[model samples]
Target chain A: GESVGLHLPTLSVQEGDNSIINCAYSNSASDYFIWYKQESGKGPQFIIDIRSNMDKRQGQRVTVLLNKTVKHLSLQIAATQPGDSAVYFCAETFPGNQFYFGTGTSLTVIP
Target chain B: EAGVAQSPRYKIIEKRQSVAFWCNPISGHATLYWYQQILGQGPKLLIQFQNNGVVDDSQLPKDRFSAERLKGVDSTLKIQPAKLEDSAVYLCASSLFGRSYNEQFFGPGTRLTVL
Candidate 1:
């Protein structure tokens, strides 16, 4: 069975500090992975995505690292802000566009 | 360009009652998706369509859930005889297919409560 899981269900970080959230996917065939940020009363928004061909990708103060050997993915947020407090989810796509999502990690940025 | 649009920010109904939600994706986007997101959980794909053709509905509970994307534009999802566990936010998203990298644009979801 294919599964993507987060190491932490919840995390707290200071507003000015960097925060890292980790995820592990069981399927080796998952060629594409993405991180999404979802705030309260809204839908999940795309954060960043990395293909298996690359080990790392960066976007606007965010980076996604993929470790195929360990089948792990991580999202790093620089300078966490109060607005960054939201649930983060990792999703993987295989042969098709259909994506499977992980449980999600709720992030709380304390000011 | 407008983002995906969903109606009725919230809905509440009793079990066995019927409900429906509407979604209008960005114009000319060939792919549309509907997802169910429970509290404290990630969104689950309930149905997907590519130009009015069903791409995937494997996880959709067909017995109670049905979705249609007529004319490859706006879409709707209906639940007949709802269940207590059906309480969740329904999200709609769209992506331009055949592009180099397809990134979906999401709309504010519709929260549903079942009694």
Candidate 2:
């Protein structure tokens, strides 16, 4: 079965530094990829999303980069803030509309 | 528009007991989804509903779990004979149309603890 996975389980960064979180997906048929941030005791929140046709998408202070060749995805947060601390998940959607999520990466921003 | 709504923000039950959570999607939304999120993990789709019809429930523990969307308005997810592993947060979300059509809006979620 195809799966989406992350390279790291945890990421720590200073409040003013740039942070990078990596993910890898093995579903070639996936046409869309989305990033979600979940705070403790809350549901996941939509971050940024990228379509197969595009390589990158940028949002408020977050950027999602998708590399189909390596089946890899990355989320870069500019000027990491304390609010950025959360569990990040990457999800891929296939033509069937089913989405498979990665294990997730926990980001900790040091204030 | 109002966001998705869920009830019983928290619950604690023993194994073999029955528990249920309710969700009401955004007004006019046609797609509803139920997901389970364990501690430190991502939300896993348990079932999906398009209007009042079941779209997918392959991942749901059918023998112990059941879900239904009555009148395409509110939905309920019931877990009977709950197990220890059932302790987690149950999240409900809805999209404007369908999974292939729009992004999802999530609810606060119902946290369950099976003791």
Please give the DockQ score of every candidate, comma-separated.
0.64, 0.62
lDDT of each: 0.92, 0.91
DockQ of 2: 0.62
lDDT (10s digit) by residue, model 2, range B1-115: 7899999999999999999999999999999999998887778999999999999998999999999999999999999999999999999999887755268888999999999
Off by over 4 Å in 1: B98-101
In model 1, the Cα lDDT at residue B103 comes to 85
lDDT by residue (tens digit), candidate 1, A21-40: 99999888889888999988
As a whole number from 0 to 100, the lDDT of residue A58 in candidate 1 is 92
Record all residue pairs in model 1 with backbone atoms less than 3 Å apart, i.e. clashing.
none
Across residues A27-47, which tens digit of lDDT does each residue of candidate 2 receive? 788889988898887778889
Question: For each model in turn, which proportion of the native inter-chain contacts is also found?
Answer: 0.66, 0.48
lDDT per residue for candidate 1 within B9-55, as digits (tens), equals 99999999999999999998999999999987778989989999998
Q: Please tell me how candidate 2 rates in CAPRI terms.
A: medium
